[model samples]
Target: MEEIEETPEEHLAKQHRKEKKDMQAKIQSMKNAIPKNDKKRRKQMTEEIAKIEADLNNKHEEELSQLKSSTDTKVEEVLNGVETMKMEGGKEAEAEAAEEEEEEEEEEEATQPRVTKAQKRRDKKATQEKERESRIAEAEVLNLQGVRHQEGLKLAQKLATKQLQIKEISSDGHCMYRAIEDQLAQRTKPEITMSMKELRSRTAEFMRGHADDFLPFLTNSNTGDMYTTDEFEKYCSDVEHTAAWGGQLELRALTQVLLLPMEVIQADSPPIKIGEEFDSEPVTLIYMRHAYGLGEHYNSVEQLKDPANAEDS
Candidate 1:
């Protein structure tokens, strides 16, 4: 029995059919053996089948290329049918391919040598960098909180200083202010209080220059007929009603007596004798008496009796 010569088209078709059948069988076998979680093994098997199919197709292409043109339509039909099948099964194929690739990669990695100390060092540095960044972020948050706390402290100090100023200006004694300062110290120390000593020295200097004005309010025993600053304030405002005279105290006459110009005084006018002026002058010179003694007060008015009195007044 002699071997019969098959046409090129028939040969190519036969080879294509054989490969397609083999691919289907391999696919079925893989589907049956594969576990849902054994994706790695499944991928490897699918890849092997695909390689085989590729080789078969390459062979068919070579054979078809050498054949006459008459079988073009038949070859195209078969190729188109294969393409359609691939399109329909593309998602499944991709999934299987990915799983297989992962399995192969993992196997390869397993076989590879362990990482060196240098590689571990690099990984450690990367981890350390990440940890450092996390710490820096945490530090930034803490710093923001600290800033807010500092700002609050500053505001509190400012308020405390203002309160202290008011207290110093209004308090009756130094002991009272000291008590208040000590109480404030038990809580957070106020920044403004730190400068209180300087503030006090400045206030004392100012008070010294204006001591005469304030002396009237001092201890009556030492002052001897002088009014205190508080008394003076009340007297000036006309709030003090305990005086000998009643009704609105006319101070304009006293101001005129004190401010009278030396040149303006008519020399011919009756000389304002000491007892005569006090007896006749309607205005009460309380501040003058409060500032100077009764005798000095009389001398002041007597000096002012003439134009030379301007210098004395």
Candidate 2:
């Protein structure tokens, strides 16, 4: 007002009191809003009020000391008591508001879905099963590829054999083989008798020479070969020869023999001598040749089979 202005101290005191009143009202509102079930919220509210009161009391220390130092003990006591009461009021309000907030949170939690222990376990098992299945399928695919490759080898052999022709006698070189005309040899006399013992002996000698390829066909009990029955079947499986190149199994066998590790075969194999003879009959010869090895493919199969000459073989 133009008539009079309040002193600085008075203006400050008035502002402080108004601020104190607002704080008290806020605390009271907080208390009223506090729910009955929230003790934690109540405690927090009380702590907050205490903090505010401590701040206010620290700021008003000068006025409080002056009043106490003056000759007014009774007045100081009364004023201090009143200040304590105001601080308590603010604290009570805050406590109530915190309690209400805590209660609302509890209610929300109660409304959410709950999972049982059994359901959680079942879900975990299902996930594990799916992972296991994926692993099994991957393993199966690898196994299938191996089987397919073996089948392809067998098919190639069967095709080559069917289409193979016996060419006329060429130079007796071990590496040379050719396709020749399919001419039937004159039928042998029925009276001509061949010794089974001789054929067996010859076949056994021949097999010993070229043991690498034949070993896979024979059962392990017969000769310590490692191929399983299924593996053997896959290797020996028949194939339909196509007309493109006139497939013959003999050609396939010859190719395989060429690639065989010399160390695993007889060393002294006689040079392949397919004389002009039977074109219709398939002659399965087992040459007495040395196994091709790091240094020797000229040793005889009989020499290799001998235990005494094992080292040299």
Candidate 3:
């Protein structure tokens, strides 16, 4: 039998159907390529597929509308029946395509390397343990200031007789205030304990009120130039509101505000006392020294009974 050549309209319809089938295949491939665990990519692929499917539906409707408008009554009835069958076929094909895609995904997942829940838990635990060990090593190194680790241990032993224990404070530029707060909490009645915030406000107020007494000493350490009025006011503001690092000048101000003697103890140096005129009795001893290039850290000292003496007694 001789093959009949298709009309231009029939050829166009054939081309559209082929193009739509190719688009569907591409959509299926894209869906399969995306990993099930990749939610972002999957969402993107879903949107793209939806757009392509909408285009295909629009094309189909346009072709049907053209065929109905151009054809006679009998031909239109025939085209309508064909359209119904095409719709049914399209639905069945879509259902089959969906099933195939799901099966492909399952097979791909089964072949991929899997991490068990138990293995994941073990990995997390190991990571935490390593972090903990690293922190402990850093803390140990921090204890040895300028001396070797062994020498530091010996110094600590020697100071043990004096019953000195260094209590570390946060180096958040408010170390002095925190250290003072800690000491005050220890010595004063519970109701009278001063918070760091309160201490900062009080110190700023005292320094501003007694500007004449402190201004001379508050000169720039390097330039030896006295602070201008504006500079002094900004300094007072920083001390009151900002987390400005405290220095000896601030310490002097604090001594006047608290009216308590403050002593600083250093290795191989005599104790330095401030506010001695205000009070004969010493309130607290703060340890000051460079800590592994961490500048200076001030820690309050707590005296305890000598372990050896306690054992002997």
Candidate 4:
């Protein structure tokens, strides 16, 4: 069968419909997978599915609106091209082709059933990019300032020369581990990358086995005494099983666990290099004291595509 060539607008619109259908079908499948006797689970899933559907509808409407705008723009462009064709000795083929495409677009708009696999990948990437931008904008709205803000600016200036930007990690007491995880995911291959739980576990295990290295520094604030064996055990348990805020000791342990050097960049201080004995390239993380109103937070650094145009600079 001969493949039909669609105008850009028609092509994009068709892709939009397929994405919507795929999402709806996925939700339906999820709904079906929930057992009928599981009333509580069914209710939760139904609510979540409804919310997803609402969001999807809004997104689809916005895209369709954009397509409508693009359609108007394309019509204007085609008219301009047709006028040019008339001026250039009346090129009948070019004008007729444009006319047919416009007619075909109208006829086929409601019948678009499928989109290519490559288009799905492109759509997914576009969605992720938009989500990233949305996160950045949200952080901007709740701006940080004063000491932390100044430090962030200084760090930004430093990173500008290196074509890097701070990718903010969530401030849920696990920022340090999360920042390291993010850096590892980007810097290392999949097999070498560690998840939050794995990183936490390794940090705890390393600290537990090498108590003398870390225990000396962990004095009780109330008693002014070194941690007892049980106290230390509890601390390590929290480090591994709970969202205990990761600190210098965890960073030190992670360097050994992953067998990679860790570089910590900070404002008002020099870069702190851990695991210097290792020969591998360091996974870098930035320490933010007050950015995003999250005190003592950690963020990862990523290189910008347009390195020449650093926005924070």
Candidate 5:
């Protein structure tokens, strides 16, 4: 009740998202490395991509389906968890009334721990928390499994319509950092691209020095408390030294440290435009929801075809 922890269903989702991203990234890398003239290898790469797409999508779908079913059979599950705590407390009161005279129930209430209102309230909160967790799991399963394969096509369609194509980044946990690296290479030209490690370190350092800006927005998932100074340090250390996933928090830090705007293009939503104060061209990255095995993924954006070298390919 004090803190929300990852349930088994969530753990399964986390595993599958990582697997999906790794497989897709691996295939994309292989495809990118093949020479243009190697039509045969290109065909092979295409085939492999198709094969893994089907396999990973099916695997993730089946696993989530099974997990969802296991949770849904109970009325307490996310989708049907509409029952109120008051109703649950009423049921307990009804049961107590059936077993004892009103005066006896009152006596028990006065002396017995099990029939006390405090105990009942605690139980209600516990059930409420479980239902909340189930709701979170349901969303994750839907995002990572039910619509996994279609995400890429939808993204591609959006990109093609917009005359943009993916500049694939690896599926590793450092995806956000790598995506920024790729974007920087395009914007700065002959300037050397910064390493993902360096970018992460810089972002972490920025976050630490400007704690006031970010800490208010972050809370301890386990304790449901605002991060203390020590916990924020630990988070910063992990950002710098660990393969912790980066989100808008790190993105905010990166925008400040690098002094540039960044655009997050998603398949289904309008681009999540960040850093409006700067006049620089925004480095663009695509955000995936249901597509990548990683469950969520980011890739650099580029012109679908280079106009200057249109006929070269």
Candidate 6:
């Protein structure tokens, strides 16, 4: 028995199907490469893939329709030369085909996913809010852990009161500056709030002017050598303008800027003091702890009223 040869139309359809499948697979691979937590990138890739898929579908449909129309025209011409009855039958077949095509187009339109720009914006906002909430919850958990550890400290210089409130600061690389700003605002008259930018500028200037004091401690952790002059200049510039993560070095500069000792209280440890002692009455207390693997964070600590004082009130 001889195998039947494939028609030109069948071959064309098979080629289009393979092209469509390959394109779909490529799109899927691109989607898979995007990180799940990166909603913005995921949304962008999704939109791009949707456009590509739409274009492919439209081009495939147009090509197939043109091929079918050419075939129909050839059939009509053959029928006209053969018989009027066959020609009339061909017209009925064409009408049925048109109806079926219309139904298929309507089904495609109904099944196509529809998402408006407004809807997309809302979804993006919701995703951002969810991520923000998750971060806040994680920070709160870390804060509680730090508080528990602080409570268990065996130091004689413990917090005046057993009860303390912790105020979390934003950990956007400027946590140290923001934390210092919060402590200053609470400890000063008229409640001064220093912007992170201003704090950065002041800290940079102080470090640059008093390089002798800070340069010794500014050695590269990897190299274990003192920072070169160029490196120190770059460090000063980063402290001044960039959102560089602040550490003990910047904290020392901050002490000089504020002209007061910046005492850091940690869980189960003596207060790590910075800068020269001042005769000031109020001392800024910062709760220091590692937060969610994001380096060390400083949260302002507000001492609760003494039980005796509360009873008198």
Task: Give the candidate number with the greatest TM-score.
Answer: 4
> Which residue pairs in candidate 4 collide?
none
Report the C-alpha lDDT of model 6 over 1-313, residue by residue, as the tens digit: 1233557697787668767776875665454344343357668888988898899889988988998999999999987876875576797787888899999999999998788999778877776676558656865676665743445342213443445545667655566787777777777473345777999999899888998988888766456789888878888998788767677788877766676777776665677877757545333555454342313456666655565553343
Q: How far is candidate 6 from the true structure (C-alpha RMSD, Å)?
A: 17.5
Backbone collisions counted per model: 5, 40, 0, 0, 5, 0
lDDT of each model, Cα atoms only? Answer: 0.41, 0.41, 0.69, 0.78, 0.76, 0.68
lDDT of 6 at 124: 75
TM-score of each: 0.19, 0.20, 0.51, 0.53, 0.51, 0.47
- Candidate 1 weakest ten by summed lDDT: 291-300
Least accurate 10 contiguous residues by lDDT in model 4: 29-38
Model 5 local distance difference test score: 0.76
Q: In model 2, which runs have C-alpha deviations exceeding 4 angstroms?
A: 62-313
Give candidate 4 misplaced runs (Cα > 4 Å).
1-145, 188-191, 292-294
lDDT of 3 by residue, 124-200 (tens): 77766765586568757775564534433443554566676666686555777898888887773433468889988
Models ranked on TM-score: 4, 3, 5, 6, 2, 1
lDDT of 6: 0.68
| Candidate 3 collision pairs | none
lDDT (Cα, tens digit) per residue for candidate 4, span 37-115: 3357678888988898899888978888888998899899999987887788567876797899999998898687678
Q: List the residue pairs that clash in candidate 5.
A: 17-293, 17-294, 20-293, 21-293, 21-294
Q: Give the poorly placed runs of model 1, Cα more than 4 Å off.
A: 1-6, 68-313
List of clashing residue pairs for candidate 1: 43-100, 216-227, 216-228, 217-228, 217-229
RMSD of each: 42.0, 38.5, 24.6, 14.7, 24.1, 17.5
Q: Residue 79 lDDT in model 2?
A: 94
Estimate, for each residue in 159-246, the C-alpha lDDT of model 5 and write its tens digit: 7766778888777667888988888878755234688999989999999999999999987655678989988888898889876768
- In model 6, the clashing pairs are none
